[model samples]
Target chain A: MVPTNIKNFDTLVVGGGIAGLQAALDLGDQGYKVAIVEKDASIGGKMIRLSKVFPTLDCASCITTPKMSAASHHENITLFTYCDLTSLNHEGQGIKALITQKPRYVDPIKCIGCRQCEYICPVHVSDAEQGDFSARKAISIPFSTAIPQLPILDVEHCMLCGQCEKTCPTHAIDYFQKPEEFIIQAKTAVITTGFDLLPVKNNFQYGNGHIPNVIDSMQMERILAPHGPYNRVLRPSDGMEPDSIAYVQCAGSRDKSMGVPYCSRVCCMYAIKQAMLLSGSLPLADIIIYYMDIRAFGKGYEQFYQNAKAMGIEFVKAKVARIDKGENGSAIVRYENQDGSGIATADHDLVVLSMGMIPGWDPRSICPVSKDSDQFITSIKPKISPVLTNMAGLFVAGVAAGPKDIVDTITESGSAAMEAAKFMSNSHMEN
Target chain B: MKNPDNDKEKEAKKAAMKTLRAQRKDLIASASSRMKTQKKDIKAIKEFLKGKKATIPDIAEGIDMPKDETLWYIATMKKYGQIVEAEKEGAFFNYSLNEPEKTQEKEEV
Candidate 1:
């Protein structure tokens, strides 16, 4: 028999990114009880980490934070941050999900977001929230705008230090905290799990992340952010303001050797956006983008590309073959100019690779959702409704279905929510 | 006067902490060693910038550390308010140790 302690909800949203937040808010505002299970401690996901969106140059946080706040503050929504979905299966007319809440080592109820423990902690480690470009206390909130505003203790580096314990006003520190498991029974489910970048270490042609000043697109975003590690655009290798910068497009995409054959649709535009931001910040610097093809297919995208070109940003139609370390913390780009120039090598103060995107989660063993050739969730009726998955009452949206931009992800999220609501309504009618 | 049950609970907690520390002895020792090395490196950089602002490459050469590693330490220090960015020198910005009074003010906050 099913446990009586199971929490019942009308809809369950997985992954708490912008897509998940949108779906949850859409259903919750309709008066349906919605539950959001996020793997990370925060719900803003990759969109929040970005500096600005493409074409509009609007602040990414400005657009994402309000949605995140709405989802968190919504009366019908329940947020399960820092959770792992053990299994999600069809149960009777509803879906049953087993979830494990990871230990924060700090009591959620007792934590007042005072940050007293963080201030007192002496151990400093690489802050992954800042792309490891800065330091954070052994116990710290993930970032300044983390939704929960609770600090997580890094047990590996904690050293059993009692400073935080002594300093915490609420006595929230608990060294013996263990993972808690729970179950959620919902009438419908939506998968909005986003994408992760292809690891730089896997591509040997790009120096396997060994060459300094050769960073990925996300790291460049953090550098461009207002509250970034350096608060300025300086190369990580030597803290130098680069006089010349280069962007290598299709670094991992369209390459069968990397097991990612599809073009990551966002890389070209993002590289151009970063180049424009860099040009604005460093007016005297030379910015070059090496690309086989520039895919500006979105609305106002072509005009954005033209604007970048008019802003003195050079677009070189070339295929970057490899990158090597250069003198004084520089990167040498070796590429074949598509203009019939045989081969050439150029040394740049910094090089940013527009890495490909891969599926963020694998639902094979956990959930029996079918995946397409690219490993994204397969949409059964893509032409009619791209949100409909093979499993009944299980809809997929955003990059979880395929590679898409923020605008498309948001639009698809709403569609998924509508489909889920319709499924629940039909199920109720049949009952 | 403390209750007997409370005293017993306190003893049990202390014993448990002792066992936990013993289990994590190796990790603690290694982390401590790393912290010590990091402190020494930061000290070397601070000493190099005692009375003068220096660029990352200049300090790396001065302290005989790799440029990349030196930059990491410098960036961390700058974030924690130990150092401040100075005037731009060519392609690099010179960094200097924060004033003693200013560091104390930051600590107080």
Candidate 2:
């Protein structure tokens, strides 16, 4: 017999990124109860952390936050933030998911979002949300616009200081909090777990992330953001406005040695967008993109590439062989020119590596969802309906299915929602 | 009358907290040492910037520290309101110590 305390929903969304948020909103509007389980403390995902989107150049946060707010405010949607899906499987006509809510050490019911505890905390640690370019208090809200507005206490960095405990007006600090486990049973499930960048530390050719001025693309996004660490695009080494910048394309993708042979499908467009933005910010600075090929395969993408070229951003058809630290915090890029020229090296004030995407979640241990040779979740009917997974009533969407651009991810999410809704309706008729 | 289960749970929580504190002893000690070093560095930078505005390169050369680490410290201090950007000097911006009392008074108004 099922426990009376088990929460029930019509559909379960495995991620709370833009894909999951859109799926939940679509199903909720269709009058179905939805549950969104997110791994992070907030639901905005990587989209919220980005500066802008490619091709359209729209503000990523502006597009993501409204959907986040809608999903949180929707009557039929329930959010399970800071959660881990322990196990998921088919159970009698429904899908059962065992979830564990990680401890925040602060009582959620009592937290008033006043931020007094964060302000009073003394310990300062490297802030990962800002790409480790700045420091945050031991206890802090992840960002200024974090949805719950609640603070997380980093027990690893905490000094057991009684300041935050005393400063919290609602007495929300509870150092003894434990992880709570729960169960959710739903008629359908959508796997929207997103993608993570291949770590630059693993790429030895890129100086193994030891070069101070050579940073990943996401760190560049933070540097370009309005509320960024330096508040402007400055070289991380000496806080100087860079006189020359270079973007190394296919740094991780299309390289079999790095184990990610497939193209990430978005790096080229994004590097172009960042270069265009950089030119606008620093008119006199020289911006160069070293690439094997420019794959402008999407609508308006070709034009976007042309516009960047019209703006005088240099596009060199070359393959960067290796990067090394130069004198006085500069990065030296050695590349082979594709025009039959010999290998050469150039020094730049800063270098940005366009890293490839890897699967964010592995369902091998927890669930039996099948994966393609590329390691992303496989769709049984990819040509006709790409959202249908091998598991009955199970669907996949966004980067979880494959590496794709934001537009395709959003469109695929809607298709997943429709497929899930159809599966639920068919099951209802059979019952 | 209090429930026996409640008492047992409270006792278990207390034991867990004791274990956690014992485990974190080394981490706390290391953090304290780091904090001391950071305080010395910040003090040195502030002394150099007393009644003067300087760029990151200038401050780093003055304190005999690496420019990158100096920039990290300067960025953190600026975020926490310990310093403020003064004006642009070529490609770099000069930073000066922020007056906390006056800033607080202005906020109050």
What is residue A148's positional error in candidate 1, in angstroms? 1.1
* Cα lDDT tens digits for candidate 1, B1-109: 8799999999998998898889889888877777777779877998899889999999999999988778788787887778998999988899998998356856866
lDDT, candidate 1, A1-431, per-residue tens: 44346889999999999999999999999999999999998889999999999989999999998998888899999999999999999989889999988989999999999998987676778887777787888888888778878888888888786889889989899988888888999999999999999989999999998999999999999999988888899999888899999999999999999989999999989998999999999999999999999999999999999999999999999999999999978899999999997899999999999999999999988999899999999999999999999999999999999899999999999999999999999988988
lDDT of 2 by residue, B1-109 (tens): 9999999997997787688778789877776676677779988998899889999999999999998888888887887778888898999989998878336736844
Q: For candidate 2, give the lDDT of residue A240.
A: 95
The per-residue C-alpha lDDT of model 2 at residue A253 equals 94
Weakest 10 consecutive residues of candidate 2 chain A by summed lDDT: A1-10
Evaluated on CA atoms against the true complex, candidate 2 attains a DockQ of 0.54
**Chain A: TM-score in each model:** 0.98, 0.98
Candidate 1 docking quality: incorrect, acceptable, medium or high: medium
* Interface RMSD, every prediction, one decimal place: 1.4, 1.4
For candidate 2, lDDT tens digit of each residue in A96-146? 999988899899999999988987776788888888888888888888767
CAPRI verdict on model 2? Answer: medium
- TM per candidate comes to 0.96, 0.94
The DockQ of each candidate is 0.66, 0.54
